[model samples]
Target: EVTGDERYKDYWRFLHDGGMRPYIQRILDHSNATRGYRIDRLEALAADGIPAILETRTYPKIGAWEQAHEGKPWYTRSGRLEFYRDEPEFRDSGENIVVHREPIDSTFYEPNVIVADPRHPLLRPRRPEDYGADPRDVGGDARQARHVVLTVDQMLSSRHPLAEDGYRHVFHTPKYRHGAHTTAVDTDIVAIWFGPFGDIYREDPRIPFINEMYLDINPLDARELGIEDGDYVYIDADPHDRPFRGWRDNPEWYRVARLMARARYYPGTPRGITRMWHNMYGATWGSVRGSRENPTGLAKSPTTNYQSLFRTGSHQSCTRGWLKPTWMTDTLTVKGLMGQKITRGFVPDVHCPTGAPRESLVRISHAENGGFGGERLWRPARLGVRPTYESERLQKFIAGRFVRRG
Candidate 1:
């Protein structure tokens, strides 16, 4: 509608008619190699709509079946498995071969620190002045001189700014057992199973359990910080260039650029490491206050029924993007099925710039308003009564009333 182009409408109509299946069939018909397997009964081999190969058998196992059975070569310049890469982009970034590189943000080093292995021929050695190390004692042997290593005392005292400011815990977001990659967790049934507070009913005054975020910390770490399980705490990450610039004298300091969550003492978590379930909801306009010019609060106006679940912040408040040079290369390469086509440097779904949310650091402190037995605590409603007919069916099944005899 914005462009007013009729070609886009035509394209949409084309897609709506038969989707990508017709295009895929055309490709199979034209290709000499795949022409033999293009039979009418290909869809019958698999229950799912799309079949990987147009053969009588099920889909082949990834990385194993194609090379072993069909004598197909792997995707590479040599058309086989390769370890060493001579690509200019790979050599420039010192990632030609598999090697461990420290996270860009969550580390003892300063933010955006330049890390390089002295053994790598293309990359330069770390400067002694950059790390505040003595010039004479730095990089004597190339093999021994890898990345700059800092002692615990040095890290806490001088190296890490966050550590010096008492933000010692390394923050990471891992997958939750109840949810499948940010889906189905919003429902009350799923929310009740995880976190310290159970599901919040629709009538509850507090935020719904789906939008409530929680932090998992080691028991020892919690003890050191005088934190107890199920206590409300404010999590503050590096505020330099993150959610905001400077910390102003706002009445609700916790509501600005900081996350509030219930602290869970988990002994299973490693010391100095903290975890939160990934994909928690973010804040809305109603959750935040306006600037001084427009001081009237939207949350207080209540003209709209769109209530924000979050009090202030989000999971991405601490995260930032770190782009790798190699991923942005413009070098042309062979890609696609059977390496039949030459494409640009960027390979779809394979090579791309990605964000590192796991590389984050935070500090936790007890919230002044909320604690054990406080008003902020959520009193979860009990599960709803089961339906009569469903209950009868379950009872009958248990009693073998529906059993079949042959």
Candidate 2:
């Protein structure tokens, strides 16, 4: 959330990789300090020289040679274990240097589960039963309690077929908008951004800053068409640029794309810059052969670099819907407002009639008897409708069997 550079770099690597700018670098440094503090506290307790049940471990500086090494060890030991031997602090790491098992706590800590932060709104106790302490006894604002909660689009659903239902489908470079990389969907509920720009969510600050992939309709466009906040509209664009092949060549992708456009408006939009996210807009293709010709608007990437322009895929397709309604006027009023070209499209991620999860709408597909003909291996079914136990077993098997294989 601090700056655009860190976020984009993370996106590019398909991994969270990048250096932060000065201001953001400071925030990261603060986080490092907090981690250091925790290590220090645990070590401080252990420094008393008396052995306790609680185990404390600290990593020391590593030599240049050790830092450059990569790949898993042949013996199956993790690099973390291997790092300890050469770390500078290991010399005085005390006699008890072996790694010990972590203690199990029935109530607070649970493996494979994100423990409630007690403060995060999503995880915080809503009633007295949550904390096991009577709410009546614990007065004061409940909102102030640091509630640990998962924001709307942060967690992925176990029901999603894409998470693990590997029936085998092929993806090619040309089929994707970019070479060697395509739009990666985090089927989990996490909000997306243009690579790693920043999070836009108020509840969870971790929301990624996605680019506006669709043709954004500013307030002026909305006003001209009398479109309200949830009103539906078509995006007028040539499908030539939206090329899909191989696995993306399916009828479901087109149908899904059409349904994706009905998104809520960021109320009071500006005159110049379009504020639409990827799926926030209506159908990708619309035909208005009447006297009123739809405008041809230009979309720009955050950095003016053409390479960074909004590509076909990416979180912009799904995460765009999470942008809460904002005034259009605020964005368009920027300088060079009039000189820029403008296009309009309905926002994606609008409510699906079937009430499926929002991400389901953005999966690629085609219409019946359209350009794509046969059934594809990965057809995304609507949400809240997938199998439960079987799906879980499948996911566990896939994660266990295939994840580490590569």
Candidate 3:
């Protein structure tokens, strides 16, 4: 739509109409493949004959695979593995040499904080006096290594908006076991084992068959906050760009800008870290409180909304996207297969425009009404009904696959 090219509307139809073959042929034409070895048609991609790109019948490995078999050079400027980078962007960023750098916002330092390790031969002090140490002190080694610390000035900076607010826990969203990335976890079968509450409303038609998002907190952290297992809690993060900010005053939205989730005490989790599945659904027009004309109270959807199964809010409520400067570089560089080098601008995920969402710090507290006390509970008539043959079979399958008989 932005390009106003109608042919680009239906990508599948465009490909079937021979719009993509030209691009494929262009790559093949530029490849080091001999004219006779290159496939003339796109159908040859699935043909029995081996394609020019495939060096062997076995799986192809990246790096040196082509260099060892064919005489093609590596994709780097020097055509060999090198530790030092001479790019101006690298020099400006102080990342000319590969080094360990802490996370942007997750760490105490501001975004892109660089620190030198005292253990490194080049960074070690020649004498104890060089680092303001007592020259009279005798030690086995010079302990002049500097560590990253949260300073009063850094806390007051706008970049560390939540630093002074005492939001200590690091919030992270990881993939769900039952889902493929963000997909499939919402289904009834997958939901049975996905969340703290599991699929308790599976048989209720009024309620969707899905699990509510929950926060996995270490037992020590939960105890300190007076949060017990299965207790409803509100997770609040940096308010600069928090979720549902516009609906803060809306009476219909409960605890706007804060994520409501059940707190699960997990001893395996670290004290300062919290985990939530990344597959939970987000709020939609149908899930939002109130009608198009007037809005009031939660779960007052005019239409059927499965996202309401998410209960209060999504995991994203405590997180925001962070863009890296190195990822935004427009420098033309050589990339692609060894034989098919393409000099182009930054390619997302490959080089540029990467979104980092795990840098958020959050604080969790018990909700005003703990547990599901004030919420409208779904107790369908089928709850006490006798199980049918189909239900029995499904129960048996679930037991065999997920639950232990003992």
Output the number of the TM-score-best candidate. Answer: 1
lDDT of 1 by residue, 1-406 (tens): 7899988878667477857666666777777546755444566655557664534233442444666678777556666777776677666555566655555556554433234445555553344455565644411122122234333344344344567788788888766764676542555465455555553442332333333567888867876886656566777777664555454544355464567677766778888888887655555444554311123322221344343334456666666665665666776354653345646577765565675355577778887323323643223211111122135556677679897887
RMSD of each: 10.7, 24.8, 11.1
Q: Taking the tens digit of each residue's C-alpha lDDT, what string does model 2 give over 209-236?
A: 2322222334344445444332333332
Ranking by TM-score: 1, 3, 2
Q: After superposition, how far is residue 224 of candidate 1 from its true place, in Å?
A: 1.2
Model 1 lDDT at residue 390: 30
Clashes of 3: 1
Each model's TM-score, in the order given? Answer: 0.61, 0.20, 0.60
Better of 1 and 2 by lDDT: 1
